[model samples]
Target: MVIGAGPVGENVVDRVRAGGLTAAIVESELIGGECSYWACMPSKALLRPAIARSDARKVAGLRESVYGPLDAMEVFAHRDKVVGHWKDGGQVDWLDSIDVRVFRGHGRLHGPRKVEVTSPEGERHVLTARHAVAVCTGTRALLPELPGLPAAHPWTSREATSSDRVPERLVVVGGGVVGVEMATAYQALGAKVTLLVRGGGLLPRMEPFLGEHVAAALTARGADVRTDTAVSAVVRDGGTGPVTVLLEGGDHVEGDEVLFATGRKPRTEDIGLETVGLAPGSWLDVDDSLRVTGSDWLYAVGDVNHRALMTHQGKYQARIAGAAIAARAQGGDSALDTGRWGAHAATADHAAVTQVVFSDPEAAAVGLTLAEAERAGYRVRAVDLDMRSVAGAGLYAQGYRGHARMVVDLDREVVLGAAFVGPGIGELLHSATVAVTGEVPIARLWHAVPAYPTLSEAWLRLLEAYRG
Candidate 1:
């Protein structure tokens, strides 16, 4: 049984059914989950046009023709098409084809191996799992505690991604991926954007240079990027007027809409975790196989596990957990392989988590940064390259301003991480993910020659920098 029929839980059910196990999934909201409807799909749809136009303006002859603003209505229409107009009928059909039972309502742990689902109509149904119960309920946007924030009708990630009309002025309050991405999209779609970052810079989780490049680009695009700024309070009169965000220093910024993209918290509060002797609102602790710690039949995958909050990583964990459950159901411990990088182990969660921030100068990275590797006690060296130095990058864009870094573990002579900050680098992340997760030796990487005159040739430049 799976609770939360998001993409994570859907993948779990798919895998379990593939292993000849019956599955039932319960969801209180949409069937396809946050990524399918709100976070990834709609957000990227909104960004693609903006990024495409930005890239076009960088080209030699095309720059003059593409300087016009994007058609905001068309962009919103495209986004709506991408998200299937916020409907899940097709997703429901897919689940039906897979033969997985779908329960629509709030699902919670009734007891061990039992789930009690409360339907929207207030009907109660208790489901007992014969094999395992997997919880894939993802996280929700975290809004900071600020005065008048709740009453001001502040937009969370959900609202930011789903809103049809762009605001005349947008005050984004975070430096994280959601904040930066939304700011980029709205600014391009014709909004005066003020990005208020409490931190010193943006994309603080990645290498410092990545954030620096992004900040510079956003500023160049006319975004008011403020660093080391704190919001003391937010006030919106009548809940529909311009929002005034009061800063810590007695300064204030007003916007037609204020979006709080601060952070995320697990969506496990009312999921009946207390019945299982676990904290009601805490992230679930999981083993390598994604089984909840201290419980054999209970599993937690996706954002709720707090392993990696990415949708792709959650789906990866779902696959591992599903396989592990199948293996154990057939036999005992003998049938399972829980060793490092084993079929049933989510080893990449720790070593090779990858992400691509779809902001105007796209930031893509896999595995660790140089700081992360050093903190992990690995003897690592970071090799940096100006992406414009690569012949392919110069051909791709006029100025072609970007940076790439490869962190190599000196002891193992393998690539520990790679970060690329520039346009058209999102697709380049998979190669780095392969190198880090496969533990490909630096010597072996030298032989994997990159194709000439493409952005991918940045790989060769990165290798040369490492050699130097």
Candidate 2:
């Protein structure tokens, strides 16, 4: 049995069924999950047009033709099309094609390898997994507690991404991926955006230079990016008026709508964790095979485990967990391949997690940053370069501005991490992920040449600097 029929859950069911086992998936909401509707799919749908127009605006001859604002209606229509008009019929059909049983309800653990699903009409179904049960319930936005904030009708990630119309003025309350990406999308779609970051900068989890370049680009695009700002209170008259946000310094700001993208908390609460010797609302601990600690028949994948709070990472873990379940079911625990890079181990989550932020002058990173590598007790050297120095980058965009950094392990002379901040950098991330995951040495990287007059040429420049 698998709970939470998101991409991770669906993948888990797919893999286990491929192993010749019967499987069932339970979901209370849409079958395709958050990424299919509200989060990744719709959010990226809204941002892509803005990014394309911005890319065109950078080229000399094309800049004049692409100066107008994005067509909000057409953009929203395209977004609706991409998200299947907020329906899950196609997803359900796909699951049916795969021969996986779908249970429509809220599913929770009842004990070892037992699942209880309650339908919307108060009907309950009990399911017993022959081998293992997997939890793929992801997370919801974490909203901070401020006076009257709950009554103010603030938009979390769900509403921010799925809204039908863009607000005239939007006040964003965090500087993380969701906040910045939504701000960029709405501002390009014609919202006057004011970004509030309680921290000193944006994307604090990434290398400092990546955030610095992103902040500069956001400002250049006319977003009011404020750092070290906080909201203490909120007021919305009758829950249908402009939101009035009271700041800590006794100042106030009002906007047509306010978005709180502070953070995320796992959706473990009310999932019956207490029935299984585990605390309610706590992140599940798991091994490399994704088996929940202290239990062989239980596994947790995705954000519910708190391993890596990303859609792609969760899918990767699901594949590993599903394979492990099949192996253990057929040939006992001893047959499981739990070694690093093994068929059933999620080794890349620790040293090769890759991410790409779709903000203008996109930010992409893979593996450990220089600071993380040093803290992990590795001798490392970081080589930094102005991305504009690459001839291909200049040709890609007139007056291009960007930065790239590669952290090399001095002891082994291999790339530990690489961060790229510039236009067209998203696609360059996989090369770094491959290098970090494969442990490819710096000398071997030299033989794998990057095409000339492309953003990929930045790799050659970094290698030359490392040699120097």
Q: RMSD of each candidate?
A: 0.8, 0.9
What's the C-alpha lDDT at position 442 in model 1?
88
Q: Where does model 1 exceed 4 Å of error?
A: none
- Give lDDT per model, in order: 0.93, 0.91
Instruction: Name the 10 consecutive residues with the lowest summed lDDT in model 2.
Output: 266-275
Superposed Cα deviation of residue 198, candidate 1 (Å): 0.8
Model 1 lowest lDDT segment of ten: 331-340
lDDT of 1 by residue, 83-111 (tens): 99989999999999999999999999999
Candidate 2 collision pairs: none
C-alpha lDDT (0 to 100) for residue 420 of candidate 2:
94
Which pairs of residues clash in candidate 1, taking residues 3 or more apart in a chain or in different chains? none
